[model samples]
Target: MSGTELMEKPAAPAKLGRAIPPAFQGKQFPLLAVIVFLALFPPLIQSDAYDLGLLNNVLIYSLLTLGFYWCFALAGQFTFAVFGMYAVGAYVSVWAARHLGGFWSGLVAAVVVTAAIGALTKLAFARCSEIYFAIATMALGSLIVILFREWTSFTGGYEGVSDIAVPSIFGYQLISGQSKYYLGLGILAVLLLLTVLFFRSPVARDLAFARDKGPVAAVTGLKPVRLQLMGFAVGSGIQGAAGSLYAHGSGFFSVEAFNIDLSLLVLLMLLLGGMVSMYGAIIGAVILVYLPEFLRDASKYAEVIYALAILVIIVAFPRGIAGLRHTLGRLVRRA
Candidate 1:
């Protein structure tokens, strides 16, 4: 146990900046694989425009789930108002498209406005934590849904906004399902990259410390409130962007589409994926999105079947589908 012997390990290399664990970093390979598969999928497998369109929806929902994961897993907040932000982004984008000329402006406006709203929500609930914060955010989401229903002129009230412009840039409209699918996939891929980068950034470290260490983090100079607000902003902005893309791509925007149920669905997606990491978000989204379709022929039992599957996942794999492989490996080693 001499000094030289003890120092031979080299202090674990003093990791200077944030970085994702090697296990999590490996997710990038699968993500890239999925992208390549998607590129070839339409022509080789799907071959149907409707199927491609369905996948585009899945991509949008994946973005929504990923955004929620950023807030819940990274920032350690339980806010569920992302649905509100999503709706606001949808309405804002559509409105902007009608008045401001095109999709780019609408997207820009949606992100900015939704981010501002997220920050404001954080400010208002700065003192609340855990369940209280969850309730307040849920309430805020409820209010947003009501506003969409009541604001006839702006939101189209119960009828919802229709005839949403096709997503375009500089007057070039993406009218085909294949075109829209690629566009949405590209946006999702970019967001996924950004999320990965965020996970490896100093801000992520700060937020992780604030969420897991709380008082210790505060004493160490991390501003928990400010970091939480930033989480909200980032999460809301991502959701908003997803909403905008969904609306413009589908050529429709409805208030009913954004509700407490949608929030719960997002939450369930995260839970199924595992709240411990971002990869869980993707796993949960893909499974939940496709499972329902597979069970469609089950008719009245679809809901029950889906519920049972989720229950099984929750009971058998508490860490989520993302962590399922690791869990199985551990069990195998133990055996």
Candidate 2:
């Protein structure tokens, strides 16, 4: 080939670039693959208990991530009482299951209690903007943790309540990691599907409307008040259910399980992931949970690493991982 022609051809493709995804490209296949891989990973690492535990931790964090997204991404909520609601679920589940006879009853009790707490929080702080709401909720979170630690009879103090029963389906025991993984995955799948359907509904759109009261009130035909309350109640119930499932899966409950650290992590996960995508919540949860394992004992510096990762993603890839793929696809098409 002629040197001039070859040089021009090479640069031409670079200038043309790759095609990008459309504004509404569906992401079912790729996301489904990710979910399947995660489900299978633990069994492949069969000999390592730590890896299994890490996987489980990611699954739990995914639930937290989804709850955060439901409040923040879908509803435009800046509430900080996630862990508080979660704690209520754990403690209430423990008490209810022990006193109320069955697992179903305990789960129902946890959801009812946590939903009430979450609704009350929204009623009190729904008017507050970001900073004040966060601070207030942060303070409330510490109080919940402290109260749980101090109330020995109810929360079992710092030692925590242990030996919780694993969840059963149709009178069958689910004691293994594999069993638990599928259970957690089933819950996550249901929630994600519901979230997707809700996003398509007018109710979900109303909640995430621009914060300018006049604009939102004027433009949107949907009932903002009812929608916002529904988002809070439903999101909070997921967190409650997640906590109940977690307590049983992990077989314990403690102050540390629902502390301020957990709160911060959940917030970061929501931020780090594409807040708009439920799958992004799951990805962020998995990465945050398993990053420590990849680092081994050096994970003591995980807080630092995690912070840097968040900054890099926010600064360099503003759309987040899930959104980045779509963004790149669009850019390619635009080019």
Which residue pairs clash in candidate 1? none
Candidate 2 Cα deviation (angstroms), residue 162 = 2.2
Candidate 1 residue spans exceeding 4 A from truth:
1-44
Clashing residue pairs found in predicted model 2:
20-329, 20-330, 20-333, 21-329, 21-330
TM-score of 2: 0.81
Give the number of the best model, judged by lDDT. Answer: 1
Residue lDDT tens for model 1, 118-235: 8898899888868998999999988988888899899887787787878875677898877787787777777776766665455766776687788898999889888878987888
RMSD of each: 5.9, 9.0
Lowest lDDT sum, 10 consecutive residues, model 2, at 1-10
lDDT, candidate 2, 227-325, per-residue tens: 666667777887888788788888876877787777788877766666646777776887777666666676678678766877988776665666776
